[model samples]
Target: MNKQTETLPDQWDAPARFLHWVSAIWVLGLMGLGLAMVNLVKASGLKFDLYQLHKSYGFLFGLVLIVRLTWKFIFHRRKISNRGFLHQAAIINHNLMLLLLLTLIASGYVVTCFSIIPIPIHVFGWNVPSLLSPDMLMEQGAISVHHMIAFALLALVLVHIGAALFHHFILKDKTLIRMLK
Candidate 1:
């Protein structure tokens, strides 16, 4: 009997690929949730409940982003290999997107941590006490930064998606398929 030596393509390892899709999904979901939360805030009703749910999603996003980063560092897959100048620019743009995602998640959690709601939750079994009251000026500042980061993340994601589609349809390259697989 001949043994088949089937390995994942050289572009990305299994774990890295999994993280890529997982993070992408989570980021999209978070974007929707963030938009909903902002709308709820404007209505001045369900504000508390919406804020709590937003914080919960933010915490999850932070955890997933950290895991994805760790997996990337560990696996160290080959970078996307395309010859065109735009392809090279895509690589740089992708890195910036990752950085923006990380910033969004980190700043989101920090804003939640300083929130005044006093929701009791444990991070990795370590109790995180609320650092600031809801009306605190510092908490307000954190919230402002968090909203800015969220917008930046959304913009980056849009650019990333557009570039991927360009590569898929226009360039007709395997770059997108490499990650999809």
Candidate 2:
């Protein structure tokens, strides 16, 4: 039998699965928090509070992404079986998701650091200074980039979720199961 038809592993390693779920939950929650912060609130006090929380989680998410990427590099990850178009599509989607997420995170950092308004990021009660000089022009550009990337990231995430469900229910393949348990 060819490699494409060979038996696959029973399941993904525990840490890989853990990272998958953690990143998913973190990104989803951040999206909700982002929506609420922009739409549901208007008061300065509330906005500040929400922004603080958002910045904190963004930092946390960055750390998680770092670890996840490191784990993938250090360990053996299962390659997608070259069985058909569905498998290839899933691989492409996964790569795009990662790229979009990294772009989102970098633009987010630029937005906060180069903000026209200097807002200190409090991590565990310690203030972290903004990384870039205050420039109104740069701030506007960063804001634009951040927003555009965020919207793109959201669409990519939806595609990822839909692909998972399609594999699980329609394709009845091990694609989703490999990550689930």
Candidate 3:
């Protein structure tokens, strides 16, 4: 069969696998940094530095996400199976993860735009000019949404990891092995 006709049991291509791992690292690292800045760090220069770093990395992650999605849909689309409910659930989970990441990135930009801080978003020395004026209300609202979505994404990631482990250990499947390969 041609590549497009292949099923889930087939291994993911090297670029797809690499992008998957990179996306995971970006999501987890950004989430951890965000949590640390909010819960552990106090209002100080260090806190500001951490927030700046978070924004920079977040900007990069957004680009990576876009490329990953484009690669998946245009270059290397996965064919979902009609075989079982488990396969369908996996597709849903994967799509939801992508949606959540997209939402987080958009909301994060809104939060930064409306932030009371008098600083512009500087991603790797590229100063991103804000289009919106500082509005405390909008900033607060977006922050709330961003925090909620972040926690939701974290939970979903845990579920994704659990499913992979279940497939590898319980089902003795190649699902996880294929990704690793």
RMSD of candidates 1 onward, in order:
6.4, 2.3, 2.6
Q: Which runs in model 1 stand beyond 4 Å of their true positions?
A: 1-11, 40-46, 77-84, 120-127, 130-135
What's the lDDT for residue 125 in model 2? 85
- Which digits, one per residue and each the tens of the lDDT, describe model 2 over residues 18-129? 9999999999998889889988999999988998898888877988998988888677555544867766776787788888788777777778888778786677887777
Count clashing pairs, candidate 2.
0
**Deviating ranges (above 4 Å) for candidate 2:** 1-6
The CA lDDT of each predicted structure is 0.72, 0.82, 0.90
lDDT of 3 at 145: 99
* Predicted structure 1: lDDT: 0.72
By summed lDDT, the worst window of 10 consecutive residues in model 1 runs over 1-10
Candidate 2 vs candidate 3: which has greater TM-score? 3
**Residue 179 displacement in candidate 1 (angstroms):** 2.1
Q: Cα deviation of 7 in candidate 1 (Å)?
A: 14
- State which candidate has the highest lDDT: 3
Ten-residue stretch with the least lDDT total in model 3: 1-10
- The TM-score measured for candidate 2 stands at 0.89
Sorting all predicted structures by TM-score, with the top scorer first, yields 3, 2, 1
lDDT of 1 by residue, 21-104 (tens): 888887788778778777746655576667666666667777787888777766574443455778568768778887888777
